[model samples]
Target: MSPSLTCTSLSFAWPDGTAVFDGLDAAFGPGRTGLVGVNGSGKSTLLKLIAGELAPADGAVRVAGEIGYLPQNVTLDTALRVDEALGVAARRAALHAIEAGNAAEEHFETLGDDWDVEERALAALGELGLGHLGLDRSVGEVSGGESVLLRLAALLLVRPDVLLLDEPTNNLDLYARRRLYSAVAAWPGVLVVVSHDRELLDLVDQIADLRAGEITWYGGNYSAYEEAVAVEQEAAGRMVRVAEADFRKQKRELADAQVKLARRKRYGQKMWDSKREPKIVMGARKRAAQESAGKHRIMHEEKLAEARERLDEAVEAVRDDDEIRVDLPYTAVPPGRGVLTLRDLELAYGARVQGTLELHGPERVALVGRNGAGKSTLLRTIAGELTPVAGEAAAHVPLRFLPQRLDVLDGELTVAENVARFAPGAANNRIRARLARFLFRGARADQRAATLSGGERFRAALAALMLAEPAPQLLLLDEPTNNLDMASVRQLTTALESYEGALVVAGHDLPFLSSLGITRWLLMEGRELRETTPEALGKPV
Candidate 1:
């Protein structure tokens, strides 16, 4: 495939002088490319540079054809009509005017040679699962996920030769994500997407991993990338072991040389004091001994230095996969202990729970639903953050709620201070000791919450909720994995694995929910909650 988009010697930095990319070079051809990396690896920044949304501090971006870009956050004008948002309002109007017997030259010019604008636009919308949203409908009438699809549909209608999407699946439901995945898989033009969606990435032709301001290309999709990385890590581990052995051997040799040199110096001094030989002869012997000892020491020292350098390099080659380890014995709920109960619960949006629903012990529940299905409302009601319109929703055990927006954290406070607020009266040292397990170490815990990246913010919020005082025995999370990169999601899974509590997580991510060991699956549909099975999720359990 020939290249359609390319960045040469690209460099960018925030106004605070924090460098994101320095002298980076990348290219994308007429095939889907998944750009992936950790939270702060500058994946989105690179996309913005390619899309011309951000000006690079140096170098240039070259594109062979027109480019379309979808940003991480899609915010359309709520008052705009769907047709206007799709960039076809004027063309459609011209076609309508021509149909109404107004043969104005301007209308003809606007209509152009391709006259199937409306049909094509509708088709694009339908392909993205937004067909129900008619051209006249206001943007505000749709949900967040619908808005995302709508924007994507607009981009598709433009038919740009190159497309740049930044975390395009951030708020999409499973069905919507599938639609997007299909569109990406079918894209014939150059496509470069920065995302954490595994399924979406798996649809791509290749994976571009951004790390430390550089991009490493992999031959296939995310699964292939993982397998390749695993092999590389294993080899790197062996190199580390070899380097360590070499370092230790060099240290031993240096120690032995130092010992011999010291003994020879002592013997020479004693011989000189005893005057065993002539003074001139003793002096020459001492000089020669000193030169030989110096050379030997230098050689051993140089070898030790080289060995240490090799060890350091080997260690750096291995990936850091440290998992959070914490004991939450206080959060345990014994069997038969009621955690929560809902009786004829009616949420604010008219969504209701049918019959009596009871949660006991440390049961893990997966709350799966489409966008605008009132999942968040139900969770809020259960957490007592929102009162039900009618009927009862009660929690017998202490509970904490982690909303999708992650507003639980105080942006003005440092990460440590936020945890301290949650665990009131707890010692700062103890709070920091626990925060370290969450990957916030030393000065990192002192970083203001406002300065954290999307992934970092989620981790801090999760840490606060899990480490809160009174030890919540029931945790209600609303879309807990939203905006989290794969690594952060793994860390969350590790952290939750240690929690001995009841969990009700409302999310569309089936893989994440499955990883949590969900014992029960609840589907929220038609204004009611119904029991479902893992097999019904359409993915292998």
Candidate 2:
């Protein structure tokens, strides 16, 4: 296939001299490509480089046509009108002027051939589930998910031949996500998406596994990619087992050869000491024995070396899926232990709850809601970060809240230092030993928080939260998987599996929530917080 976008010998590094990519080459042909990797594997960075958001340190990116990029973090000026944010304000104004009987050449020039720009823009917005929004409405009026859709609608209006989206579904609710999915399914150009959203990846034409600064293409969607990788890992494991057996066999053979040589030497020494044969005959026999032993030793050693090399190569072929193995006994709550309570609460941004809400024991709750529906506000209220206007929102047990932005860590501090702050009075060695479980081993634990990638930062923040001194019995996580890759998401689920606390995670990731073994589902609407199931939400658990 001919590539619509290509990178040749691309290189990039942070200002701190941490190299992300070096002499990397990638090509995206005319199809939807799901770019996947572990956190900090440079998937997002590569998208930025290809989209011209970040300048490469070396080589170049070549595109066959116009490109559109939706960044992971979409920030729009709140004061701008929807049309302006969509890059259609000028064109729309010119069209309106011409329709109002203004025959000016400047208006015609500005309008160009897109006399139906207004209609097209609105159609794009409506297609993205923003039909209620008007071109004159301010961006601040829309929710985060709506804003993302608006940006995507703008990209669609321009009709770029190559589109790059980095975590495009991060802020989207189920309704908005479905809209985005439809758009992705309909996309005809070269679409490269760096996302942890499995549902989004399922729509892609192929999967690109980015690992250690290289791209390995898989010939289908996420599921196909997963199956392919499982097969590869199985083969790699078998090779490792075979190599290990050969290595052991070589060791045994070498040891046996040494033993035989030693016995022969001793026998010859004994014969020489006795002077059983004539002096010249004994001397020649000893010389021949020494040469024979040397050659035998060299042969065994060579065979052992080859075996070891095979073992090393086989081991290197296997993938590393390091997990967060943590045990927080203190965080565990016995059954029926009251953890949190909300009574007739009135939250910030004017969301009201009329009834009492209670959380007990180690209940895992999944909070699902639309963007701007006060999920974060509810979590903040439970965490005591927001003051409720009416009734109290209280947590009886010690609680910790991890927000979407992951602002728990101090940027200036190292990972170890940050964890130390969370776990005061804990020994330095203990903190590091625990940090290793979070996959920040040795020098990685010494890395500054500011220098870490999105995944590393999330892991560091999670370590601090889970390793806090009080060992929080109630954990509130808001969109915990926002910037995390699929692997990081799995690691998070593993970590949460060991967490014996009550969890109230506010996120749109249904698969991740299902993996957590949620015991309750809470849906947040304008003024109602009700118990609902995945079926009621029209999604699988």
The sequence of per-residue lDDT tens digits that candidate 2 reaches over residues 297-332 is 999999999999999999998999788898889899
Best by lDDT: 2
Clashing pairs in 2: none
Provide the global lDDT of candidate 1 against the true structure: 0.90
lDDT of 2: 0.91
lDDT of 1 at 149: 93
Total backbone clashes of model 1? 0
lDDT of 1 by residue, 226-337 (tens): 9999999999999999999999999999999999999999999999999999999999999999999999999999999999999999999998866788888899999899
TM-score of each: 0.97, 0.93
Candidate 2 TM-score to native: 0.93
RMSD of each: 1.7, 2.5
Model 1 off-target regions past 4 Å? 1-3, 539-541
Root-mean-square deviation of candidate 1: 1.7
